[model samples]
Target: MTETLLPTATGGEARSAAWTALRRVRGHVALTLLVLTVGTVIGLVGPWLLGRIVDLVIDGRTDELLPVVLGLIGVAIGQAIGQTVGTAMVAHVGQTVIAGVREKAIRQVLRVSEGRIERAGSGDVMSRVSGDVETVNEAVSGVLPTLLDAALTIVLTAVTLAILDWRFALAGLAAVPFQVVATRWYLRNAVPVIRAERVAEGSRAQQLLDSINGANTVRALRLESDHLAKVTAASDKARQLSIRMAAVQRRFFGKLNYGEFVGLALILVVGFYLVRGDLVTIGAASAAALYFHRLFDQFNVVLGTFDTAQSATAAFARLIGVAEMATPDLRDGGETDSRSGRGTDGSVSLRDVRFSYGADQHTVIDGVDLDVQDGEHVAVVGTSGAGKTTLVKLVAGLLPPEQGQIVLGGHDLAAGASGSGHRCVLVSQEVHVFADTVLGNLRLSGEHTSETQARSALDAVGASGWLSTLPDGLDTVLGRGGHSLTPTQSQQLALARLVLADPPIAILDEATADAGSAGAKTLEAAAEKAIAGRTAFIVAHRLTQAARADRVILLEDGRIVESGTHDELVDANGSRYAQLWAAWSTHR
Candidate 1:
């Protein structure tokens, strides 16, 4: 399967993304532009006042010196105030934009099909969320505003120089051609290089995360050397890309320095001629030279910030791309029943089901049909690669089959009837416990659940025994840093939350597989209580769970080979369930 967290925007798409982001904060943008304009205008007053003061001093007008100096100070103060306010406003707008992008991106990720995320891998998606989002933030907050200030400064200074003397303005702009060539060359070459750098960095991060997550497995298999080698290679590649980027910057800066030299040389050389010809006063020439010098400083700022600007552009595009992945409203063409509470019956049915991870790969789930009655416990057993988990995911509405229809409580599962509607809840083996109070963790199951309700649910899942041992009972915090829970306790807590959620159908995919023998027993009892009066499907790794189910299904290569009650399957001489029972009994 092709693994991609989100689509990468092309040139046109990147522009559209940037425009969209700007439009979101148009009011702040307009205000910032006004403030910056005021600041830029105020900044011009100082240079002009300096020139006037120089002329006055040369003409021996001592009386005007104090007034000009006072005016210069006032202009400087005004410029400082305007710049501070402008920068703050820009930062506020940029942060607002970043927050909106993050919220939208999170929503999109939450709504995307689970199958897509599973195929894409967590590292890739996380990189986009954390790394790309941060990159965009830096671009908006720092690089963009700096570039804008530099641009405005350059424009106003050039215009002032022109008004003073057209010849001086022309001389000041002598470096334009060289600067343009160098900038264009740098941008064109740097884009692909930086893009490669980002890709390499993401790969390196993924490699490190993989090693960390699988550290125990690596140690057990004595594959530390192999994993370390992989990490080293990825890190080396990232280092090389970083060095290449630095080299690109070095070359670009070298060219920019040469341009600055040429421009400054031309300005001084031209200003000397104009002064010698008596076409311009010494003060005017001095002002023109200062303008030229200031202009080059602004140009340098622009050039220096260009790399970050480009990187931000790329990051913005990626962020926007992920945000755009939100699925279309599933209720668009569907009818909404006036139903309020979840229906009592939780019967589920799958018809002509078929699914595959990718178009090019073989179908993992072939055309199959099944019926699960209300409040019936069905345990599905299969060997590795038998599509057991995929089947349950389809029924639980976590995935959509390529070609099939799943109905729950007479409502189409795929037609926006399921999510958070108490229709179905799937508890997989890997359950996450938030860093929150025990009460808070339980409340996450039902947003409106009261403390009393939470306590009762915990009791129902047999977690009350442990709950009382905690320092603060239900109020006691549970995840990292608070109260740590064992694997069994964690699974029990998950079951408690399930009881609170009280979905009509509960799908448990080896939910107790991680618990020890004693913990597994406790979890089994808790699971039984949690699923009382609810249609339950257990993807059983241990045959004991299947033996207690109302019906046991045996699957082979995505096809249902045999299905019957525990007693009936055992009696069937050569059936798949009978063979499985025999093997399970021997293992036990």
Candidate 2:
């Protein structure tokens, strides 16, 4: 299968996401800006007072010097207090915006179709959810306060310089040309560098996870060295990209440093000539120079964070790209008022159903028609590539039929994008064990399910044996760092979850295939109990499973070759079902 990634969002989309989030919390925006303004005003007072002392010292006014020096101390204290409060307020606002964007991104990820996710590789999807969100969060909470503060300081300081002498302000303008040129260059080049760095990091993480997860296989096949080499190559690539990204950032700073050199020299030159002409008082010239000098630090703060800011912007765009993914419906099954999917007879019908992989690929499921009444237990049996799994997926509303529609409980089963309009669960051989407590994982099916109810469900699914052996019973954690379970136990745990979820429709696609022969029988019995009252479909490779079904359908190359009760199919001596039974039974 080819892996196709979700493209990062365009600049317009990132800006739009920001604008939307800000609009929702305008109250926070107003309070934060007001506090920032007050803090910047306090910052302006320090430079002016320092200039006053310089002038006072020239005139030898020791009587007034003490008060002015004391006042400078007061300004320093006020600026410190204001800055502390301002940082807190701005950080609060930044977190709020991030929370909003993160919420939208998660919602859209939830809505994405299985097909889109398969096409976008598991690692890429995981990267968007975890890595991109983390990058945006660090940039926002960490960089937002300083960046905004520096920007405001630069703008206000220039205004103060103009108040003292416009030539000082014009002197500042001389630096703007260099700064503008540097800024354009940095933005033009830095974005791709940072974006590439992030992508490399995602790839590295994916390679590491794949290698570690398949360690046993790697060792068994003597491919440990090969896997290690792949991991090393991925890590090395990420490291190189990161270094290159830093080089670009350093070059930006180098250019900005040149602008600072030019601006400071021009300001001093302007001040010297202005003093000679006496267009401004000696005290005022000092004040303007002091103000311009203060700008150097603030300017650095803004420029130093430009790369981080660009990274944040790119990360935000990636997150919003996730939010932008639409949940495609298999068909037009409008919203159903009944999430329980009750009130109608629990029946399903597939008419002339056809499905294929890509446009040019041979059909995986040719045109077919079938129906099963509510509470009916039907078994679909076939060899590999017989379209049994595809049929179950269509019935469970996981895949859409290419040529026809599926009707469930008198409503079209569209598997509505958000998983609304129908209540169903599809259990396959692969079961995901979340990094949580056994109870916590089970509660994901129904949050309000009581502990007593959870225990009963576990017992019903024949997990009581291991459940009792667990250190904490249902409360025991069962993920990566927790107690491990065998494949059989894992399937049992899944069956228990199905009992807890208790959806109106339950589909099992080789759910017991992972178990050993003895474990398979146990799981099959447990599965029967779990899906007792629900409309169910089981795709089986085992003939015993088909023999026990209320009705059996034998599929060959994506078409139903035989359909009947177990005994009826067995009675037909030369039939396909009979041939399969003879072959399977002969093996036993």
List model 1 lDDT by residue over 1-588, tens digit each.
Answer: 124546666768777765788897888799899999899889888877887877888889879799889999999899899988888888788888788888888777876778887776666678788998889888877877778788899988988999988988888777999899999999888999888877777778778888999999999999999999999999999899888888999999999988889888988888789889998877888888788888999998999888888777777777777887646343322223233245576889989999988789888888879999989999999888998998998887778789989888777766663432357888899988999998889887767888889888889989989988999888888788888999988998899888877778899999999988888898888988989888999999778889999999887777787888999989998887888789888986
Q: Candidate 2, residues 1-588: lDDT per residue as tens digits?
A: 213676678899879878888888888888888887888888798888887887788778767889888888887888788778888887787788878777877766655655566556667778777888887778767788888888889999989998888889999888888888998998898887888877877677777878888899999999999999999998998899888888888898999988888988998898889989978657777888788878877888888888888878878888887787655442323333353323335578888898887678889888778988878888898788899988887776666677887877667665454333345678998998988888898887778878898889889999888889999988899989998988888888898888887666788889988888999889999998988888888887577888888899888888888899989999987888888889999996
lDDT of 1 at 373: 97
Candidate 2 global CA lDDT score: 0.80
Over 4 Å off, model 1: 1-5, 219-222, 269-280, 326-347, 352-364, 383-385, 397-423, 446-453, 500-502, 516-518, 541-548, 578-588
Model 2 is weakest, by summed lDDT over 10 consecutive residues, at 330-339
lDDT of 1: 0.83
Show where candidate 2 strays beyond 4 Å: 1-3, 200-244, 277-279, 328-345, 351-363, 400-404, 410-421, 452-456, 459-476, 481-489, 516-522, 586-588
Highest lDDT against the true fold, candidate: 1
How much is the lDDT of residue 299 in candidate 2? 82
Error of 2 at 188 (Å): 2.8
